[model samples]
Target: MAGVAAIGAADLVAGFGLAGALVLPAEDPESVLAAWRSLPPDTAVIVLSDAAAEVLRAEPAVRAPDAPLTVVLP
Candidate 1:
């Protein structure tokens, strides 16, 4: 399985998939959650765009104590 995943703006993450990162160019919370839920279980890192990070502010799944490392882009 892949080691990294990304979810956020299309323009920012659209090309990340080329590098083998699981990229989901999503903007809404629903899409964001869907992206997260669909990631390969072995994914280790997750990068979120500013907007996508905000959408997940109150979300526990992605913020779980044992969840993958998450980085929020500025």
Candidate 2:
């Protein structure tokens, strides 16, 4: 888990060059969905957990083709 956290942090830093804001969603699915839906179209959502990522991927509200969503699982 520590290694995953370290990689996630590094990825966050590397993603800074992108054109949108970086979002780290909560562990819960509902919270993740809420945060994802609230972000702008260009925003980058970094989902760390497999569970949350699965939920977000299944959620239609956050599945816009134009939305920049990234799911990182470990």
Candidate maximizing lDDT: 1
Off-target runs (Cα >4 Å) in candidate 2 are 1-21, 44-47
Reference-based lDDT, residue 13, model 2: 36
> lDDT per residue, candidate 2, 1-74, as tens digits?
11111012334433533533353435456666665555544444444456656766676655567545465655
Local distance difference test, per candidate? 0.86, 0.48
TM-score, candidate number 1:
0.86
Error (Å) of candidate 2 at residue 72 is 2.0
Q: Which ten residues in a row have the lowest lDDT in candidate 1?
A: 57-66
| Native-to-model Cα distance after best TM-score fit, residue 41 in candidate 1, in Å | 0.7
Clash pairs detected, candidate 1: none
